[model samples]
Target: MTADHAPVRGEATGGLFSGTHAPATVSFAAVMFLTGFAALAVVPTLPSAAQDLDGVSLYPLVAGCFVAASLLGGVLGGHWADRAGAHRPLAAGMVLAVVTLLVSAASTSIWHLAAGRFLDGLAGGMVAVSVNAAIGQAYPDRLRPRVLALMSACWVVPSLVGPPLAGLVTEWWSWRAVFFGLAGITVLPAVAVAVVLRGPSWGVVPAPSGEGAPRPALVVATAVSLGAALGQYGVSGWDLRHLLCTAGALVLVTAFASRLLPPGTWRAERGLPATVLLRGLGSGVFFTLEAYVPLLLITERDAPPVVIGLAFTGAAVAWAGSSWVQGRLLERSPRHRLVAAGAIVQAAAVVLAIAGTLPATPAYTAASAMVVAAVGMGMFAPSLTVLSLTHSPPGRQGHASSAMQTTQNLGQIAVLGFSSALFNVFLGGGAADAVGYGAAFGLLLAPCVLAALLAARARSV
Candidate 1:
């Protein structure tokens, strides 16, 4: 439906925060900012935390556990939102986030840290899915792009300041303080969301799916989590047992993943399913490649940590800028074309990143590539999200939004896992670390190119 036809109050105002949604908007943005701040703040500390805990070998687990656990949270949260509005799950998710932060704050071992991260992921995943579903339900089509763009923009201040402040905190005091600080900061937003989201303006009629998680989806969510955990473990080890575990994980993931996504998602079935596929592909390639950016810059180029942090800050700004541009253009431009353009830019950035691996390449080359790639992701992500909401029927917005989250997470895990395994294989074969990094980056090219090819299929019918 066009702006004139949408069933919402803010079409004539052109202001995302106008009318009934202002309170909810503030609450959502606050939550996003807190999470964004905490994420950037804590990421740099994890390696140190792992080292101090003597769990350096489990570093990948610390990262993967969150994403793995999020799958369950996403599916379960979606089901809950569909069954009983978004208020309860969202409130519960926020509370869980606070608890998880405390858990991480007090951790004395790597296992404890991993457990904290896993629970954090669960809470975070639920909060993310619930918020997206809320947005889908709350805003009309005319406002969705702008609203989602605003969501992206919420990362701006956090991205700019979080890392440096976190560095100071880690230097002056303890890493545990960061977690405690974030937990404390989160309480305000949690309370505000619970209060503001209870009004009639935020009410959503429950979907027809009964009042609980679907048994099959819950089962699939469990399989996906297990598969992800096993996959991460499998790639980290080298024995025959590891190989067997890898094979089993793949089998389970392959068998059950189809149930979690829309039918024909694998084939890029036209319309909503294809949009979903593109979201996964774009996210998968970029994030998988992104994980190595700091490592390569610090290890290969000997770039200073400050420069590395600034590079990420620059990328965040670019992402928000691109999202704002897309929001402005949504009325005049077709989403598929925008997605295609973004995908092509992302692919080029990936190639540039690989070139930056050369010893003679400029120190800023990798940073530039990362920044440009962020622009592409920023442009496409909200567009696809808007499409997901517009395409689904009345009651299934939760399902569609949940599927998007699931696919994005799965994409990250699958691509990162495969590239990690390849990186290890190259290292085992005596390739230089630089060469392994290059090969790993090269592995991402396939999905990037495919995403560009399939972008047109994401067009709404």
Candidate 2:
């Protein structure tokens, strides 16, 4: 069905607010922030959870599964948003999250925890895609970028609150209490979204003349992208060594997603294409560096878990600070400039982390450098993202959102997957572990450099 066949609203309906409805903008932003908050809140308690549940290796599985499930959710949610409209999926998603947290907190086995996480991941995926789509459909072209920034900022909050909040809570009470705390906190916002999202007035029915028809190209691309994710996981897990698998997955996903993306996106020529490319570059390089930083500190530097967590926190804090600053100045800069600067900052951070591999440098020195790099990335994010959202055609806005998100996630999966594989190459022997991890870090440095180059070119082309 094309946009012409869909219903279009003649006048603006007052949404959740009293005068001109903000179209649940606040609700969407709140939901996103809460999602980030939940992620942080859960991690600190996860280990304590393991101890409470008879020491299962389910810790990694629980968190990993949630992330894995999100990949599924992000894809399906895009299509679902196309069909059912955003409100239903968005509302249903929140409810799903609530239910999952309850079950996760009450779990006795790893499977239960995993199941809850999967369900929650599913919901998060739905909320992210649907809300994103709604923002595209409901708002005028200009507001879209601002909304995307608001939405993206949702992930930033967890970095700030997730670690310490979880730390203090777990120390004072059982880790399980943290889950309960999250549950209690969610109720208020969930209810607010539910209330604000009510009535047909607040809803966004895909426009008849708009671009939201579900495309077969997207389904194929998502399938290929998802398969690629699985293949990358195999590589990361060391179960598969066929560079063919990783390479094949990347090619397939690239081809499929290209069809779903705008005309110039495959080549990443300029304008919105550049923005998409920056999103990929910034996220991939930033995360690839992040993935190994912990392992480096723990093994080579002999840092404790708390120290490792803090190092992670330092980068996250930097990330959050950047996000806050960028959001505050949403109207001032061109998107491409932000992307270019962010890319450079991110690459510099990777270089610093790379240098830290020398066994002699103070761990905090490397950590602090990474945090500084994150601040640069923060500058890059909202602008690059806002540019994409504002530029996307209404009919294809949902696809754009998914495409950008897919690129970011795929970046992490691919670059970090490679990082994981290389780290495992030297797993057992102490000497090998040091050398291997360093080599892996060394291998990825070029991409960050290349990404910076690409981001710089984003504006010109």
Candidate 3:
């Protein structure tokens, strides 16, 4: 570690809200809350927007564009942070976020809306990476967990309110109103954060100098992002064209995605590699469940939309609560143990979801799957992040953070795509709907188990 890169221990004497850390902490938290609100709110409006634009067939492309663009954004933000400081990227991301919202609000066509979403994703990815890098640079090791937990908590209110509020606006007015409202509400706070971050105190630690940090390959990142988006669009339907697109996507990701990650990440090498891999595994399990569980309930169990909404709200609350426990009560626990326990808990949740696919099982059983999985993620996600930062070399925390972000997006794309393929195969084989759902949920167990087995690899040496 360089002299300036030394850990800033015991400097947070007055805590996160105290004199020194208050401005940056509040600014970051506020930005997170707004970003969460925009993300959760905008998703529910996309379907309505597509319908209004007469481009319903292209909805998957529109939806997937954000994730694709985020891959590029993560690399860009991480590189910028390492080369400069996290504060600049953070401010730039917030500004771009507001601009994207306005762009969406004025959209006259589906492609325009897709462009806005892609820009939003880019901004979101930058903000996410920069925030993690900032935390690594600004906070001490001891305070990082709490900061992460607080970041998780920022999502709780957004998850509870964003979707329903968007629904109401769409019902009473137009879907575009949501974008305009978000932009109007976000602009001032975004500016405030930008100004606050410019202060000398924020990102006080200078970036690591010399040849320790290597720049990420932007071309490969672009391919992976494009591949991920195409993969998502391909899976929306079953056709020869879609299959070919999916095949091409697989080739793109398989060929170049590994170059962006730490060495041995695929094999879960001990230390940082394992930590990054664990992020993917745990995220894959949770996201697959989140995507499928609600669909299962609505399609098979005849559950109401209100029921589904409440389930989402409950899951967010559970995640926040569990994150709180890990950050405070279990603050001293070994992170590897927490990760292992979380994986086991997630595996149990997957089992419950699978059981809910049975004819005799009640609808609530499946709806609860997301809440349970969230509890596990609450423990698993932050611990992996802490481990990644802890294991990172002096000047490479940005690289590690970017790799974690990249793998997380890849995990979502890969796991969800695979599960969707399995579900389609069962349906095409003339199996019953329950059978298809069962097969999909059944596939999730493997990753959860593997995460448990590899948790120890992430332990500090």
lDDT of each: 0.82, 0.66, 0.88
- lDDT by residue (tens digit), candidate 2, 109-184: 8777777877887777777767777776666544544556556566765876687888798899877787778888
Q: List model 1 lDDT by residue over 1-461, tens digit each.
A: 56333444234444667765677788989988997887778886888788889999889789678888888788888777776777777888998999999999999999999999999988988888898888877776777788889899999999899878887887788889989999999999999889988866455554555533233557788998888777877877888978887898899889998888888899999887898888888888778757888778988999987778878888899999999999986555888888888888888888888888899898678877888889999887888888887777655777787788889888887888888889899999999988998898888889877887888788886
Displacement of the residue 44 alpha carbon in candidate 3, Å: 1.4
Instruction: Looking at model 2, report the run of 10 residues with the lowest lDDT sum.
Output: 4-13
Give the runs in model 2 whose Cα sits over 4 Å from its true position: 1-25, 50-60, 137-157, 171-173, 199-201, 205-266, 269-274, 304-310, 327-330, 426-432, 456-461
Top candidate (TM-score): 3
- The all-Cα superposition gives candidate 3 an RMSD in Å to the true structure of 1.9
Clashes of 3: 0
Residue-wise lDDT of candidate 3 within 1-461, one digit each (tens)?
55454334234555788776777789889999999999999888999999999999999999888988887788888878876778888889999999999999999999999999999999999999989988887788888899999999999999999999999999899999999999998997689878887865454343346645667567888899889998999998889999898998999999988888898999999998889989988888899998999999988999999789988999999999999899999999999999999999999899999999987988889988999999999999988888988997555777888889999998888888999999999999999998999999999999999999999999986
List the candidate 1 regions with Cα displacement exceeding 4 Å.
Answer: 1-14, 206-215
Cα shift from native, residue 53, model 2 (Å):
4.6
Checking candidate 3 for backbone clashes, the offending pairs are none
* CA error at residue 52 for candidate 1, angstroms: 2.9
Off by over 4 Å in 3: 1-10, 203-211
